[model samples]
Target: MLAQLRQQAILERVRRTGGVRVAELVRDLGVSDMTIRRDLEALADRGLVEKVHGGATIVGAGSTEEPGFTAKSARQQAEKEAIARHAARLVRPGSSVALSAGTTTWTFAHHLADVPELTVITNSLKVADVFHRAGRPDQTVVLVGGVRTPSDALVGPVAVAAIRSMNVDMLILGVHGMSVKAGFTTPNLLEAETDRELVGAAQRLVVLADHTKWGTIGISTIARLEQADVVVSDTGLSGEARAALSEHVGELVLADPGADEREAPAP
Candidate 1:
């Protein structure tokens, strides 16, 4: 109970301040240095914070420092899984789907393991690996060639060129942040351009983002909210958020973390 409370407090402080120092945490939480270190380590393990030399920072804080894959994998486990499950349902067998690279998108790849007769085009080494290792023989995987980003994504001209050449049935995209004004934004410029091209290549675009993405703005805008065909999020979203999203997106699908069913707004 004490650990959970401390964890929650750390999360709140991180959200408020964008980052926190070990000494500051010890002073503010009134805990021992060892205890504070443990807290930070646990948070880092969960992908909530990036452990620095003396402190920790938020994963996507306006900086070039990228969180390690292990750390990212730990953060938002439940939410990503739920989003992936919801995304998998949108894909039909024998259809070509383009998946953008991100931890959340990687989760979507896992759920596609059983999807028979599907063709996937992606720029993620992790996504390709998932399909190569377990994907059925009937399924075809096309991995775009490009320089890999810190988040294990391939972007830039090579990736953009590949996307432009092919037409995909659906695109499952992930973003660093989304706002009514800012649209879909990311921290990396090259990634933003590649995402824009991906959106253009697909007949339908579905954005997979969690509630935490609300209100935050990144450096570059890929597309507006209205540009997305569908948006899938968790039930933890606020009423205002639901209404705000409904105004832009054609369909809003809210998935319950506890169940497989989804609450979708009427067409």
Candidate 2:
């Protein structure tokens, strides 16, 4: 594709999907990674898109504009995978855990599928399905009932009530955004309420977020930074954010995505 055509294609994808990843663009456009990065940079220079760590989000998306799960899954693919692997270490075998709805938590669920005698309670259909497909005879999954959101989160009074009656060793929570001012947040009001219930049900709160979530406030705040027992994110997070998290949260883990790639088995 020509420069103008390729950039226009990239811009359209971002506008339609709320974001577009550089890797996806490179593959689909049949171009080099550098070429796709240049296109994204050009688009960013025009204020057509906001450049994130691994992707570009649509310009002027508000706090209430929740992107769908598929859109979110495409951005920060490696970061989420790295965070998942690192966070999985927190889950002891034969323990109960709660996973809130988000792409990162969904990725984390896959890593936990084989843990013996594990019980998973979740408000995400996607997360539950991960365990269902695994069909681990020794594991149990409790999927809450509620209205489904664009991100596949089951929320409402039903989900909140179900979670309140349960207790888990850990809550692997994911947020739309996090900052000193907003703490952890989500675009959906019901999701925030349901997530708070999940937070209350757990003995420990381990937040899973990527670098791009910083400074991006959402419509509702889930919990304050001090409430988190641990926050697991990727190395792409900024130094200022790291300092803030370390001071407030019990432990701040920065997963190295490069290390994950290096450690992967050869195909």
Candidate 3:
């Protein structure tokens, strides 16, 4: 495809989906990675799209717009995979962890099942299902029941009530959008409350978000950046975002999905 045609296609995809990954475009267009990157850069320069590390998104997606699980799952595949791998390292065996509903948390649940003697308490039906499928006696998975959101999360009073009584070692939260000013947020009001409760119930907060989440702001704030113990993101996170998040969150680690799998946390 010609540069103009390819760029137009890129913009149209971003317009329809709110985001487009270069890898996906490369496969579909049968072009080089550098060519796709160049096309995204040109579009970004024209104020038509927002350029991110691995992809581009519809400009100004921060304003209370939220995509469902599948939409999110498709946006940043490699980044989520890398972040999940690193987040999994934080879990020591025999620890109780709380996972919030989001695509990244669902990915983390897959990795958590491999750990020995872990009890996972989560508001995500998808996360619970991972353990259910694994059928591991040593790993106990708690599925918090509540109102189901489009993102496949169980939120609201029922989830909050359950979270209030239990304390966990960590809360691995996936957010709709995050920023220095907005902190961690969700577009759904009830989900925000449940996420806050999950944050409060844990000894530590580790947010698992991809780079695209940086500038987006949801309707409700769950917690401030300083409240987090750690933030695990992919290397695709922009340098400026990395600097800002590192400053506020204290410990910001980047995950390279291409890296060989590191040893899991010691039991």
Candidate 4:
């Protein structure tokens, strides 16, 4: 149909240019102003674009592939916080956990401050700074040394080597995308390689991702779906996604931003 073609063209333009104005859409798609508005609204509903003052921006736009920290931090604040709170419950006091880099992972670090007598290891300077500012002496923090990525993650051979030497109780991983085939993936190859090392060093792997990550494919995969012990995601996930993930992961915890209790298997 004409609407479908217009939608595809709009999406392609947004992906190529990072964003598009309503006026621009009207001009480019040769559609009316009302039609362009409807298309944008539909795209925003699907989590593909974010509506702003004059127009919409692709949700995750950049040559970097991953959204910048500030942009990502603002996109799904409530959902990430809810996911982090639920993930924090999985970590008990006096346990060692490895937290990966990303805005979602950073939110998890914030929720973790209340947890006492925990050792947290990470290659994220931002995460380290947050914990340092909180000053939880009862918690021991390990900052992995390596080359920093555009997203502020420490990666490369040095980081991978350091991560391989330590064993942790749990690994809370974050990624750019998650597909049945790709499992868990990142845009940066070095970061993906480092993630693999972290996965190998932990007894349990818990993935922290929002619903938008579903069905997307990134540059490199770190682990298979079956390799994850648990996956913590927002309730925005589709029914098909929930079923697909449940088949491979031991537990799929769905956190509703508006609710206190999360939906998960009754263990």
RMSD of each: 8.5, 3.4, 5.8, 8.4
Which tens-of-lDDT digit does each residue in 17-127 have in candidate 4?
Answer: 566677767776677898988988998999988875456776754323764454455456678888998998999999999999998999999988888999999999889
Name the best candidate (by lDDT).
Answer: 2
The best candidate in terms of TM-score: 2
* Candidate 2 residue-wise lDDT, 1-267, digit = tens: 699999999888887777887788888999999998999899999999888767788777688998877568877888999999999999999999999999999999999977899999999999999999999999999999999998899999999889889999999999999998889999999999999999999999999999989898999999999999999999999999999999989999999989956878999
* Alpha carbon lDDT at 196, candidate 2: 95
Each model's TM-score, in the order given?
0.77, 0.83, 0.76, 0.76
Candidate order by lDDT, highest to lowest? 2, 3, 4, 1
Comparing 1 with 2 on TM-score, the higher-scoring candidate is 2
Residue-level lDDT tens digits of model 3 in 133-231: 999989888898899987789988999999999999999999877899999989999999999999999999999988878988889999999998899
Error of 3 at 62 (Å): 5.5
Q: How many pairs of residues collide in each model?
A: 1, 0, 0, 0
